[model samples]
Target: MDETSPNIEADAPPALDPAQQSLSEALRVSFGILKIVMVVLLMAYAFSGTFSVGSNEVALRLRFGNYVGSPGQRVLERGTYLAAPFPIEQIVKVDTRPSTLLLEDEFWFETTKNDSGLTRSQLQFQKAGPLHPLRDGSLITGDSNIVHAKWALTWRITDPVAYLTNIGSKEVAQELVTLTSQQGIVHSIARLTADEILRGIVNREQMLGLIQQRLDDMRTGITIDQVTLDKVSAPLRVMRSFDAVTSAESDRARRIVAAQQERARILGETAGEASEPLLDLVNAYSQATELEDPAHAQEIETLIDTALLELKINDSVIGGDVARVMNKAQTYRTQITEQIATEAQSFSQLLPQYQLNPRLVMTKLWEDAREQILTGDVETFYTVPGQLELQFNRDPEIQKERQKEQLRSQKKAQEDAESNR
Candidate 1:
């Protein structure tokens, strides 16, 4: 309580031993060094919590083992951020760029090895399959045909959170992608028959679109960029058979198309040939129907008959059967044409005679009819218009009776003459 001087000497009355003072100083230094070392370690530990995400990457943050931020907002942008160290919080960097999966042996059906006791060099030169079906990965088409199909697909992560949460790991996601793509290719191939695929009738573009669609439907949080079809063919052992069948089908189709085209051409040509003559015949017949004058109608009738003959001639000329059928039709047409021409000429000659002398024409017509009717062993009689009608008693029974009576009288006179002698 007295002014500070002697009391301080009382509190510090016991002085340190020399060795003890050295030991105390040394201990003081050690404590200071330990404090400095601890400060440095703390600074280093704090710095270790800082991490950065590149522009092409997204960082997913989690606190206490739970994702921090909204479902979509949990992804960190390209910048530096301090996260609580290790067990307290975590950061996962996800690359959001495009990636590709090569599908070859994984998806493509392997060709059968030539186990037919062939030499190794021979098998290598000509790879003949039918080797091992169970080991081969092939797609059986709708037509029950098998084919090898290989394809490659490119994809990218679009929704990082979904990708991380749903897939959980990049490796698993990649494996899923490859498996899904294989399924897509196999499914698309199943719908197409082997012939359709080989002949290009299967729409390749549509198949690729279906692959992407399937991937999208899986909600794999990845965008399909492209699908490349590397190979689509039959196995080595069946290549020759496949080629032959394809060739035959192509030839059949080609022949069918050619026949159809030929038929069309023949029909067109026949129509062309028949048009003018048939049209003239139609006009002539129509004009004759409207005509009141006898001579003019007859002339038109003659022209129509000639036009019909000409039309027959033209139709026979155009057809696919250019040789045998055409010739037969043409010959028949010529015969018909000649007959029509003859009939037309006969009418032409008769028309003027009929117009000039009508009575004479009637008389001649009657005489002609009489001559035709009485041509073979037959009798005929004529009666003048002003004269009485003549009668001929030509009954067979009366003639026979008269002849018998005359013969009996002659026999009786002969008997009387004999008796008088």
Candidate 2:
């Protein structure tokens, strides 16, 4: 009885069979399941969201609709990171990539007239609260013609949050751009004529920037890249009048250019005419010198040229040059005489062109030299019969000898005629 009672140990609860072991394992599994549940509760955190930021993107985290923190200039390059979800924290993704968008504004166009005499149209005159187009509006021209214009604007969002928050959405930004641009263009068009706008690229750009300024004042974070005229279509009713004005401008430009060319031609002609008298004087002076006119010669021409050149010609040099030239002329005359006497031997080859004998050729040349040496002016042509008669009287001996020969020839002719009789 003592040994059996020792077998029941106080510290040991039980010695189970296979059924007990199976029951213990089932309880163990239950405890492990409970531990897994606690771990899941600890791991699944609430109020967290994911951030997918690209290489050029940044995420601005907000808490309770207020700015909590924002990524710096460099983007949070890794994509899809978890963050405190919305309501506790909200993440706004911003694109830093270069981008652009274009928007066109709605504005008033041409109108129809009513009995009230005001410009009106069914589309523009119809009232739709704030959405009605304007009528009787005008567009400024470069050349003062009333033009109709519409614009296309291209812009970029430089700051995404600022753009989204301030401008509201891409749709709202577009609407503001269109409206602001229309207002600016219309106001500027009032200051100019339609023709001015048509011919100007730079002017249109400046006006577009003015429109952008209107939106920027509202703190819209959009940067206008450019503004362009989409079209300058005109009202069909005023086509002829505008065409007439453009034609007049073209005519004015043509006439102005023609007048300038004519003026240049006249100036050139005047310069040419101004030099003609000097050329004539030089030619006349050359002919006189060739004839050995005593008052006009190459020395006098040289003196005149030196004076015109603003150079000095002293009396000693001028007188010495003239005397030396006269002496040289005489020596030249002797040599020419010797040559002519030698050439007179070739009568058959030389005399036929002149219808003269070799002796007559020499005699004619001698007379020409005599006229040249004594003449006060150029040339030795006879003009009237009386002057030729006077010239013959200067040689009395040759005349008397010719008269005696005429008498002898006449007597001899009479004797021969008597023999024939």
Candidate 3:
């Protein structure tokens, strides 16, 4: 046992037999193949995590089952993207395009035998009748009227990150959108009456706006495009009766409008014809006051009669207003006749005295006229017995000339009579 021998033994390689050498060479080859296999598997695992986003789709990348990007940076646009292998990072592709959901509401009827509900086919099999409260799904209007309604909602994903994170998937998001939209529809229908919906008075677009506002409040990244109604009507059983009532109402309205138009036309024609006569009648009444003579009363009465006659003729076109005018005019005629009779009585009393003494009656009439004219502090001057005479008449010579003319007229008349003889 020498130190040199021990050192040489530790440093020198051991001698192998042929069988041992062959086993050693096989082990090296096996390790190389195993390493190559592991590299291939790892490369396959990393490649397996890659995904593609379409033009209409957005890819959301998640690391360790959690989202990896910020609000704005979370979404991957239309391109191929690579992430860490599965279990480290995951990708979910969501379609951001518009989608539609159709919702249908059915009407149910009740019979004596079955009060639960009647399907459409069952309804067809039986006779049509009123719907049952238990079977039918309807909106209870403000006026307590019930109506069946069906509509569809169209929506699209606007914020992919919010949509993906909040709603999980497109299918789930659609379901949520439809649910909220239906709620909005029910809310809107509750505010309207059956007549408003049936008559097209309520704005359908406003309903869509309400549904959209609901969706926005939910923040499910769903944008409602439209809300379209498919049906709005009363129950099928009473539809015919409803139509009949509607038809009757429309007919009544039309008849009322036609009657109003006819009335306006008739009144317009009568007014046009009677306007001038009515004006003349008013003027005649005014002139009667100014004339101050009972002799012209008959003329004024005749004018009123003529005006009433014209009104009666114009009013004859429409039997209604004409009868009224005729009755009023008859009353007016009676009043006029009575006034004329009173005036005639006064004239009759004066006529007898006037015939008995012309000069005395004339002088009395002149004195009465002076008394009526000299009212309210008026002065009367009569020059008598050597008092200073007040002669206001400067044209006394004109009166003398009038007397001379009268004599000339008598002379001319005598000359004409002699010539004729």
Candidate 4:
């Protein structure tokens, strides 16, 4: 041991203070927390690019101000999607739900609101002054008549890319739609009369098609759901006159409809569904006859006769007044034929008797005739061998009785005819 040469223990480094050690440990923990916070922030930034599209919404993704993906894939449907956040990628959402817009004053008269929240036009007999070109709006009809109308438009975006690129916003799209619709209305109304416009005789579908065509040409990418004419009329000053005309027109239409229905009913009752064809055939036959073409007339008459014969043979084929008349005619013909046949048979049977006893046969026939005459519906009076110049004046009471009996007989005959039919 060389104690006097050197001391190796004395050359060792000194122990750190407790405070510095504690500070060092704290610094390490702070760095670990900061790293964790930075990771959380980065995750948040990444997830911020996630978006959810609703059922009625369409989304488009653009990278560096230019559209991304293929044409079909450019538009995103209802789902969740992710993209690079912020300046690297941008998302545009378009609502595809149907929206309605009412253009009330575009072609409507200037109106003032009443105390009850109703417009002046809604009130009865509210007069309006001369048109103010700056304030009031109106449309000129084909007849150069002034008319007013209010319209409602329902639309929705069909193509997201076109709508976003062309229209860009709802405000701008609404303006375009309004302008286009106004132009369409002006053009359509200019081609129609005021009466036609008020009566709804104007072709609304064609007008809407024209408007849609215009939109298509402009590539608006909007589909029209519907276009409704809410109100239409002349100016308030002539409202009463217009209303009178409208009411008259409505009455005329109703009367026309009723007359048509009555005509149909009469024709149906006359010959069922065959009435029209039968009438046409009869008219053709008449025309042919008027032309003095006997051959054509005869041909048409034969066809008509064949049709009638078929109808008579099969009553069920046509159930109408014509069928009933035919049935009655056939019954009368059958009765007359049967009567003639019976008389002929009886005469044949009585020929030998009459030849043997002619006087007796004559007396018997006279008695039969007298009996039939007495049993008939006439009032019989027997005056014995009178050339007495008797005045023949009908008794009122007897005439009344006879008339009643005749009416009863006619009613019975009609009932029997109907039953047979």
Judging by TM-score against the true structure, name the best candidate.
4
For 332-413, candidate 2 gives per-residue lDDT tens digits of: 9899999897777654565684575667878877898787786753333456655344443245665677789899999986
lDDT of each: 0.72, 0.60, 0.72, 0.85
Q: Which stretches of candidate 2 lie over 4 Å from their true place?
A: 3-50, 55-58, 70-88, 95-146, 200-202, 247-362, 366-421
Model 2 per-residue lDDT at 309? 39
Question: 416, model 1: CA deviation in Å?
Answer: 99
Quick one: how many clashes does candidate 1 have? 2
TM-score of each: 0.51, 0.47, 0.51, 0.83
Model 4: pairs clashing at backbone N, Cα or C within 3 Å? none
Model 1: C-alpha RMSD to truth?
Answer: 26.0
**Superposition TM-score, candidate 3 onto the true structure:** 0.51
lDDT (Cα, tens digit) per residue for candidate 3, span 267-333: 5544434544454556777787788856676777776675455544334322334435565568899
Per-prediction RMSD in angstroms?
A: 26.0, 19.9, 23.0, 3.8
Q: How many Å off is the CA of 119 in candidate 2?
A: 25
Q: Give the 10-residue window scoring lowest on summed lDDT in candidate 4.
A: 311-320
Candidate 1 lDDT at 108 equals: 54
Q: What lDDT tens digits, residue by residue, belong to model 1 across residues 151-250?
A: 7778888878778777777798788888777777777778888877666565556666776676667666777777777666676667777878879988
Model 4 TM-score?
0.83
